[model samples]
Target: MFTKVMVANRGEIAIRVFRTLREMGIRSVAVYSDTDRDALFVAHADEAYSLGPGLAAETYLDVGKLIAIAREAGVEAVHPGYGFLAENAGFARALAEAGIVWIGPPPDAIDAMGSKVRSRALMDAAGVPIVPGVTEPVADVDAAREVAERIGYPVAVKASSGGGGKGFRVALTPEALPDAFEGAIREGERFFADGTVYLERYLPEPRHVEIQIVADDHGACVWLGERDCSVQRRHQKLVEETPSPVVSDDLRRRMGEASVRAATAVGYRSAGTIEYLVSGEEFFFLEMNTRIQVEHTVTEMVTGLDLVREQIRIAAGEPLSVAQDEVRPRGHAFECRINAEDAEQRFLPSPALITAYREPAGPGVRVDSGVRAGSQIPEIYDPMVAKLVVWDVDRESARRRMLRALDEYVIEGPATLIPFHRWLLRQEEFIAGGALHAELNRMADAPTPLPPADGAAPAQAAPGDEAPEPAPQAERHFTAEVNGRRFAVALRYDPPAGGGGAGAPVPAPKKRAKRSAGGAAGAGGATNEVVTPMQGTVLRTLVEVGQQVEAGAVICIVEAMKMENEVAAHQGGTVKELRVADGQGVAVGEVLAIVE
Candidate 1:
């Protein structure tokens, strides 16, 4: 076993890897950006070093800087936690060239499965079941149109080097194909620096299911089982569960075998997941995630396997200890990604300083979190604050345990998906395990009003009359300046009191609704709040107390990623007060506005 390993990432996953390393009596090193200087993982590591600024391009994604840190720390191996440079094949090769063990799959395996277009062809040659789609990159819009016509409308345009839903778009008709193709190309170019894209048959309402596979250098491999990740927004998984209620034992075995074949074809080692889309009994290949997944907690809860430790063992030239039959799943397990987002608005990011934080604790309840009470959720990275996972003898028991855990999980200074999760657990579709990828979309499209909170006080319309149809209490908005031009941003927020249960109509700019106040009352219905749209510094606030203004007026400017963004008013009202000033640091949804 290696004496020390440097975590080539930050946040919760880094801390998670550190915990496993500590348990194994291995020293751990943490790398951080300037913004994450005071991060919990940094404090927990036996050694630490600065990567660069908060900018991803200069920090986590900087492979050269990361290798330098590894060498300076004198670590025997480096573990690239999920995200950042985790799946970068070139980085893994560089690590090997530097004579440091890369605690992941071999570089060639990563390369083979790195590109979706290539991987699909490879999987087809290996006789693995794959989604029926184009085999080559689209040459032009003409080729895409031809493929779309043959495949029928509602086709998916995906980037050749895309994952995590970036550089992906869906076109429902020929007329929308041009826009979708262009959007996909633009995102691919910007994010992946590879404008190559391909077409796939779009499964509008398919369930997102995937299998976890772990292998060793000695050619031993096992499928830990499968997970259903149907609950998602914007193609990103929000909730996951093990032993999918929809997947039969026969189908699970078949999928597990297929996953093994896919890995073996590439000589894959370490931990990876083979994702698929399921519709009824038919399953189609989606893509392969070549790293430990954010949803791995649910699998670990059910299988009693430490995937990280297994990854280390595999890297240390040890054979996998468990066999296919020995890999038995105990019970149903569920994981809800506790992101710093509000479910009431639009699942907008809600990064802020957690004034108070408390994770649920008990048997069968596990929380893999990186933040504490004083931790600030930096906007430079993903908004996922933690993952709340629970296990039970059955799905119902697991659902109940998840609800209990969510209720017990306390967070202050930012709105979260806790309320929405609580409401979802009580819904008929979720309870019956009938949720699909389109479920959230259906709820979002519903034309109903959100119900009031259980103990929320009624709103006083205009500060005098008895609450005339309680409007939603103060919600937050975030802003990110893309260029020197201060573009008005529509920050993400959650739904109202009912969460996504009652199916409220998507909010419109001109629509006025009454919201009941949840806590203390304020003058003219103002509570003195201002929130950042993107992770950046507060450049200036243009509003003052008793300032009369119309709706859509600029109130402040936030400098994020070197761009200036203007914060605007949601309603035509007077500014009651300003919570922050010029040059003050802020995060997403820090409560910047209090208008009457």
Candidate 2:
């Protein structure tokens, strides 16, 4: 084993790698941006280095700076943990040139599978089932149309060099092709610096299944099994599970073999995931992720393999620890990406400080979190705060455990997808494992968008001043009837002329009232109830006495997992009262304001 390893990443993945390194008696080094000076991972590592400013381009993405840091730390190897520089082939090659160990696949393997276009051709040549489409970048709209015609309608225009669901568009009909092609090309250029794009037949209602493969430079390789990540939004995975409910044992073995072949074709070493789009019994290769995955925790839970450890050993020129026959994926495992997002609001990012951090625990539950109480989630990176994983003897037990874990998870900062996951678990189609990728969209009750404030308006301010003027009050009364009873709650309105509360006095209850009585009694005043739209801490309350706000206008921001999401009014209303102040911890649906 190497004496020390520099982790070229941040957040939960950094911490995860550090923990494993410690277990293996290897020293771990962490690099962080300015915004992450106080991050949990920094403290977890044996040594740490600053990587400049908060933005990824300045910090994590700065390959030269990272290389310099690794040299300064005297580390034998650098571990790129999944994102940022993890999949950057140039970074891998640069490390190798600098005489430092790169804990991932060979640069050639990354280059082979890095480009979607190249990967498709390679897979095709290897006799792998690939989605029928253009093998090369389309020449023009006419060329694109021809490819679409051959591939059939409902094709996707995808950037040749793209990931994270960016630089891709779906054309449902012939009329949508031109725009889809152009938009995909534009996004491709902006996101990847590559305007080249190709066409592929879009598989509607497809299940996102991927096979995990581990290889040693000694020509030994084994397939770990399969993970289903169909639960996604905008092509980004939200939840991933192993031993897919949709894939049979025989199908898994077949896919595993194909993945091994793909890896073998490239002389792949280290841990990599081969992603595939599965529709019914038919499976098609998507692309290969040539690094440890965010959802690797689920695979670990089921396979009992320390994938990072294996990656480290492989980098050290170690042989495969287990043979292909010994690698068996037993039981079921699920990983919920505990992102700083509001599931109700189309899974929008919710970034805020973590005031109270409560992780779920019990049988078959594991929380990989990179945060602690008082941690300020920076807004310059991914929104994933943690990963909640659970394992059970079977899928049903795993589902039940996941539901219980989600319910018990107490993150009183940015809003999270706990409720959304809760709703998904209860869904009949989801429970039956019949819910396809598009079925979630077709479901009627996709958790109503966060309810709006009753009578809130935006605040405006004079030039050169900091605050915007408080919203003017509306003369509408607000009432809530919970459980059949009605209560009189006061709704405060904007002040008259001198900037004071002159419209209505906000009623203050001496003690907590009954849920039914509280809802019924509050008629004209702002109620005490303030629900947070997502998991995160209250950064600041942008409202005060006599301030008014319109429905859908931002009332406050709850930061979770380092992203600031605007908590908007669900309905037009005036500001009743600011319930939480700056730095207050809040849970999802833990009322943030009572708009009247």
Candidate 3:
């Protein structure tokens, strides 16, 4: 076994790796960006190194810097934990050339599965079932349109080298193909540095299922059952559970065997997952993740296997510790990605200081987090704050335990998806194991509004008469900046009779300046402008000055927290001014372009 291993990641996954390394008597090393200097993972690791600024491209994704750090720290092996450079074959090769063991699958395996087009071909040749679509990369929108026409509508325009819901767009009709194709290519190049893309048949209501496989250099391979990751939003998984409610014993056996065969065909080793989209009893290959997944905890809870430990052992050239026949999964488990996002506002990223933090405890519950009180959720990386995993003897018990754990989990200073998870647990369809793709859209569009606060009630007034004031109360408290100086203020209001409050009401706080719905006024009138809906980088500007556009036309694309959002014009007009250019940083409500 290796004596020292450096985790090339951050947040919950880094802490997760550290815990397993400590148990195995291995000295864990952690690398952090400037913004993460005070992060919990840095404090917990046996050794830590600086990785420059918090920008991912300059810090975590810088392969050369990571290799140099590993050499300096005398790490025997490096574990690329699931993001950033985890799937980069070049980084793995670089680590190997530096005489350090890479605690992941071989670079050759990552290379083989790095591109979706090539992986589709490889899987087909290996006799693995795959979706019906073009296996070759399509160049430009015209070529994409032809391919989509051939494959039929509702096709997925996907980046050849994309994962985790990035670089993918769906074209449900012939008219939508152009935008989807261009958007896919631009996002592919921006996120993965690869512009190659392909077409695939979109599965309308398939359950997302995957088989976890671990292999060793000595040719011993074992398939660790399966996980159902169907609970998703915008193609990103929000909830994952082991032993899918829809997957039968016979189907599980078949899928496990197929996964083993697929791994063996690619000469794969270490821990990996082969994802599939299953509808009814039929299943098709989605793609392979070349590292430990975020939801691996549920598998560990049910199977009692440490996937990271297995990965390290495999990288050390050890044979499989457990054989296929010996592997037995015993209970149902659930995992919810506790992200710092507002579930009511389309799951927008909510980065702020964590004033208070608490994790749930007791039997069948585990929390993997890297933040505590005073931890700031930076906007540079993923919004996932922690992972909540729970286990029980059966699915029902596991569901109930998850609900209880969610209720007990407390966090402040940022909006989280806690309410959404709680609501999902109580849904009848979710409990019945129904696929949630369509239902999720409906929920996001019109979520149930939260109830009023305790003791709060609507005020009733008599017709035509001035409402009588009952009492004065402070309704809201916040801080504001005046002329570059900050001051705390409270919003006060007088309530009618029967309201519970005492004393005279103080004046309300001054209101902040509000930007006009339109942009800067032109000579004719106020120019209608398209503004960014969130803080992010401008990925592209789709409109130019003097260009005539219609209402709802997309004018630009803004990427926030790694998710791309289209900024569209509000009304039909001619483009008057372009305020921002590509690659520029923008704040929420900042005007991007003006249309007159």
Q: Enumerate clash totals for all models, in the order shown.
A: 28, 68, 0
Q: Write the per-residue lDDT of candidate 1 for residues 1-596, one digit (tens) a residue.
A: 89999999888899999999999999999988999998888998999999867588899899889889899889999999998889999999999999899999988888888899999999989878777788789978999999999988789999999888777899998999997898788668866788999999898778889999999978688999999998887677888999898998888888899999999999999999999988887788888989999999989998899999999989999888789889878989999887765554435455567766778999899988888888887655777888899999999999999988976777665556676677677766787896644446533322122323332222324632233322223333345677666664433344443221111112222233322222111122233343444456676677788898664556776654333445666545677868888778875457777887
- After superposition, candidate 3 runs with Cα above 4 Å error: 443-531, 545-551, 569-577, 593-596
Candidates ranked, most accurate by lDDT first: 3, 1, 2
Residues 236-261 of candidate 3: C-alpha lDDT, one tens digit per residue: 88999999999999889889988988
Greater lDDT among 1 and 2 belongs to 1
The candidate maximizing lDDT is 3
TM-score per model over all chains? 0.80, 0.77, 0.85
Candidate 2 lowest-lDDT run of ten: 515-524
All-Cα superposition RMSD per candidate: 11.0, 12.0, 8.6
lDDT of model 2, residue 89: 85
Which regions of candidate 2 deviate over 4 angstroms?
442-447, 450-596
Score residue 118 of candidate 3 by CA lDDT.
92
